[model samples]
Target: MKTSFDTFISEFQQTDNPDEKYTLIEQIISSLAIIPYGHKNLTKSEMIAHKVFVILRDYVIINQLRQKHAEDTSSQKVLLNVSLLFMNLCNNINETNITVFKSLFIHKPLIDELANCLHEISTHGKYLNDPSRLRSVSSLLIALQKIRKHNFTALEYSLIAPILFSVTQCLCSSYALDMIKSLERNFIQELDEVQMLFLYAMPLYVKWYWDYCDPEYFVKILRILLNDFTAWFTSCQPESYLQRSSQIDAMIRHLNYFLVRPTEFDSMNIFSEEFYDDYCKLVLHWSSILSSILACSSCTMNVKLAARTSVQILYNLTLHLNVLNFMKTIPSFILMLLKVTDLDHDEVQLNAYRCLGKIMIEADIKTMTKPSKIAAVYIAFLKDTIDDSKKTERFYSLLESLKSKFLSIVFFYD
Candidate 1:
């Protein structure tokens, strides 16, 4: 079997005709797809699989490079086949063959090629419209995700930086947003697998390459997702739902990372006038969504979780004075936060109160139009603190502290 596979690979490499090469690759894929890794001929099968992987890796690297510089439509079918072959190999990997598979598939050059292929598909016009592009992307992402399930050395993490950057760039591209919209339109209330895989891959990449990734790119992608969420919330379709709770969770996770790494995110121009305006729009949309969700008596836990995350993101944004200033200008935003403070969820209420405190603490009472509303929210919270018999002593202490902190500002304004 080894000899036969070696001969096949040689024939594949020596072929000058693209058609012949494509046919040869398909044959190889078929042969490797059936290899019984659990059978008694495991050693022979492993040898054959290893040889085939080496050839496929080389083919992917070379063709990906070619596709990068030129619009090679003819190669698309072959690349798709190769990606599917990789996915098959990944699917068959187990503890016994893990080392062998990783050795063959975890090459840095091959990873770079995969990343470049995705980047090209996202940026190039012809590739964007190709019917097989999404499938190819999905296959590649599956294989990459499988490989990434194993632990990597520091050097390997360094090698995968290109992949992370490419994925981020692709996610932030206009093409990705358009593709998501198209999928939503076609599927109507379900996110496509390709979109979900992209979302899944993002946090893993961020986790592995946070130090290397640009904060601006993260912000750009987050803004795109927020806009999508806003649209889903405000769309005319009564049956349309915000089925992207996972997306909201992702946003919250990434925002939490940004908050902890203040040196990396807080010091940047992420809060410039342009970003501030974008965030203002996001907050207004989020406010409206939160108001609607609060009004619904039968809102699901997922929707409420999403609403809480939106407020958490808003609280994180308030760490910057510019955002706080903008929040103060929007009465709907203040009212939404105040309504959130009345929610039963402790974490949600904490974030809401934090947001309100931030916005009002630095607020100019002389220019403020809704100081009365802010005062009312604090007074209501105080009343709740006084009237609730189930409140613990510790809870009362925390509320009393918050009351002192907020009442001082209210009296100063009065």
Candidate 2:
């Protein structure tokens, strides 16, 4: 079986015709898939699998290099098949055979090939319609990521820098849309696999290469995800209907990571007008997410509380970002907060009221021409919450500040 597999690999690799090569490779893969692993303490099957993996890896590497520079569409398709085969073997091959797989070569070239392929698919035009090609590329990267978990090195860490840079570009590119569409064909639309891949992989990149956590990388990754999150936000079925999904959870995890690891990411020059403006946009986008989550009555109180906390955190981070415009732009913002203000959670209520205060002040200034009517509108909106016995004293104080700051001349007799 081992010798026949080796013979099969040789024939598959040596064939000049792409059609025959693909056919031969498919047969080889089929045969390898069904080979029982238990024969003679699994030695025979493991040996055959190991040999097949080595051959697959070598062929994959060779073809990846060819694919890297190949201008001919035929060469590109053949190379793509090699990647697909690599993914198949990686998925089907057992972990025990990995010991044999490790002896073949250094991971750097494979890593480089994987990153370059991703970058290629992202930057090139022809590969856009090829779902098989894109999935094969993503699968190779994910397989590498999995292997790196148990066998890491400085070289591996070094390679991830470029991998992440490419990934960042990949996410930013128009190809990312294709990648998302391809993944959705296979997975759920709401929690897109490609987006989830980046969301998970970027943090892992940070974990491995902490020194690479500069502001440029930070801003690029954040903007890419912010754009994706916005897309998800607009297209997502309301949270009420879908059971808990990764869409919201993924964004929350992303925010949670940044919030917890501030020393790594917080040193951006907030004073720069451009940076500050971009930051405000990012924060406001995040605020929209929180507002959406809060508005969903089906979401658990815990999730709502979490969303409120995230809002509070954003408010704290961007005290200077004109929080009022953020609130106003997000149509659900004020209403979401009002709903939360009467809730039993003190922290959530306080945060909601505080956001309300910002909105009132902004409303007063923005509607200065019609300040009285605007203030009346806001007062009328808050009248129910104020009437609630659960309202905290500080909540009233926040409302009073809203009045003083927005409508000081008009005294409230109550």
Candidate 3:
């Protein structure tokens, strides 16, 4: 009366030997692979799937505990097989089996263990070129993606922090990229949502690991964020509105942190010259991206809001002396700010002009060759300010401050 599933579970539980457990897990994976998608019968199928998931989850937890003492090759093989089994189960998940799947795997202990396994595999240079590790990592990421899909709340900041750090570390290797690309090609065809999942979690990731991650790591993270933002902006999917906003906000706020130079009162700060240089380069790159977004005549109102927010951050950067000096080095960056001043959006134009005023105050008049052109832009901006009846008195005050600075420059030029 024993089904093959029952028999496999019995053998899997009885085996103390890793190799035997690995074989049984492989058999279980192979057997699960044949289960037809969307079968009508629920009771028997759910019970069987639940038992398999529990067995694999238990084995992974035990193996993880054992791994603390020593590295076992046999144990790693079994772990890879277990991950493969989880991937197979994830593929077969449906409304019928989803509850069972979430119940067994969405717990913090299991997620932490899986993250630990991924961290171990990803951080080791020896595993970089190993096909088994690649498969294991891909399977683990798919499993995590399923968990993320089913219960995003379960992946709170604490649980997800290590996973994000590990994945970022893994991405340093070309092998990991190949593995992720393979996953994208084989499983999820639309886009690399797995990578986007990481990017989406970036606000949390940076919050938790900012002090720990190196400047180069942050540079890499920012680059990925910008690239994803560009893609999302171009495609402009209706559903991805929140995603785009979150990414834009995260990038802008993260950049905002660099604008505030660390003072002697700040004991916990990790500010360094190298980090400053990286921030300067990122600001220049982000300026170019923002210019394109603002210049796009067809961009949405939401995109305009994002650009305005970014311009405000850029203006904030010009307030800091060191960052302002770095900003002054890039004349094209200055021109981008000036060009933004000509845009129709009031807040964006105001912020861009504020940024320009800051630059003009510190920068020598000769560096800005077109003094008349600059004066014309300021005059037009001041005229627009006077025409708006709803314009706050604060605007008038700021205009006068900038006006005096520009007048001094014009006098020197004359």
Candidate 4:
């Protein structure tokens, strides 16, 4: 009598016949571990294994709508099995630098079903959070990147966020293309107007840690997000949801990087304007983020850094423009930069003073009537700076000019 392994091979050879394909694969997979290798040469039997994996992957998609996979051989259970099976198959094929993954996964269009199968796997939060299972997903994404649109399938990360963010960050490293792919996927909502603009100027804020931790990889991903965000923001459909999303707020948080590394990105390559028109608008947005971020942190060191970075980006960019927004924005810009005093070290205070000086250079005290309460805060800060024993002569000098500007406008109203 022939063994079960022999029966599977006989059935597989008949695979060209559609009627026999499903049954042949089902029989082999149903008893995959049980097949006796008693004295058989397993290495020579790969053709049989490849055929089995291919059929199972296709089965889930063609039958996804089946009411029974929901209960009997549920799509849920089958999906979990497929995710695991695909990973193992890749590993098995990769034992010695083999191209089994490409041949089986990328070359075959139907295999994208694995990405969908993962959507079902993600539904069971308990299972997804399982250490072993989560690692399986990271592994799958990483391997997929080596082939094709693997990164394109990252929408699954958004579907499982809060945890997905934490997990992907945990999995991040120099070689983890999957984590980046997932991040790129999360930024895919370009059609949402507010989401797009905030996205433009966003990575500068929301992505600080990710960008600093691995700049080369992170920047590549960020640029992609920014390009998409900028395109969407410039299209100008004019939706009211602009205030609804934190995109603009998030951009303000990390405005420091742009100032310090202004040369890091080529303007023509990344931003649309050659000068500071949008950079000034960005300053306004960042000031809001810093104020929001500072309210949650009491550390003096942090407050100072946030303030200084805010001032620096605004100060430096404000100097480069020949545009007329200087008078339009100076009063509010100075007020925003003033709040960041706590984060500065000895040098930051000086750098910040220079930023104020740059803005003061273009002042028009005759225009931009800011509110009285807002003007009072600037007066109070200037007076306090003048009184401080630690004040650098240069800083105090810059303060005198700003104090003059503030009082010049305030008394005009008085």
TM-score for each predicted model, relative to the true structure: 0.51, 0.48, 0.39, 0.28
Q: Which ranges in model 1 have alpha carbons more than 4 Å from their true place?
A: 1-106, 126-154, 168-210, 214-264, 332-335, 338-350, 360-414
**Candidate 3, which segments miss by more than 4 Å at Cα?**
14-20, 37-45, 60-81, 92-97, 120-126, 154-157, 171-220, 224-414
Residue 414 in model 3: lDDT: 50
* Per-residue lDDT over 1-414 for candidate 4, one digit per residue giving the tens place of the 0 to 100 score: 136556665667766874465556555555553434332423233542445555565554334422222434333444444554454444333233344445554432343333343444433322332333333343344334333222222443233233223322322222122222323222113223222212222223223223223344444443433333333333322222122224332432332343223332233233324423444455445455445645554555444554555455544444343422452454565554444433435444444444543454335434534436445555556666665433433345445445445455544665
Who wins the lDDT comparison? 1
Best-fitting candidate, scored by TM-score? 1
The clash tally of candidate 2 reads: 0
Residues 1-414, model 1: lDDT tens digits: 666677787898787887787678778766755875444444433762556667777765346544644356656666667777667657655556666766776677777776777677557743544545555666766676666555556787777777777777777777656654554431134445455444444444454445556667766776675455435433433222244545434533453334322223344455444456555665665566567667667656765675676677676566556766777888666667776766666667666766766665554424545456556655665666564433333245445435434546655776
lDDT of 4: 0.40
**What is candidate 1's local distance difference test score?**
0.59
Q: Which of candidates 2 and 4 reaches a greater lDDT? A: 2
- After aligning candidate 4 to the native by TM-score, how far in Å is the CA of 399 from where it should be? 20
Which scores better on TM-score, 1 or 2?
Answer: 1
- lDDT (CA) for every model shown? 0.59, 0.51, 0.53, 0.40
Writing each residue's lDDT as its tens digit, candidate 2 over 1-414 gives: 667766876887687886786567567656655654344433433653455665566664556454634455554555555555454444433445554433433356665766676677557743445544554555555455444434445664565666766766665666544433433321123544454444444344343333444556655545544444434433444333224345545434543344223223134343223344444555555565566566666656657656655556554543433434544666655666566655555556555555555665544444334345434545654675665433333345446445434345333321
Tens digit of per-residue lDDT, candidate 3, span 92-202: 555456666666655666656656755665555444344444455556666655544433343353555666566566544443343333322121123333333333232
58 Cα displacement, candidate 2 (Å): 3.4
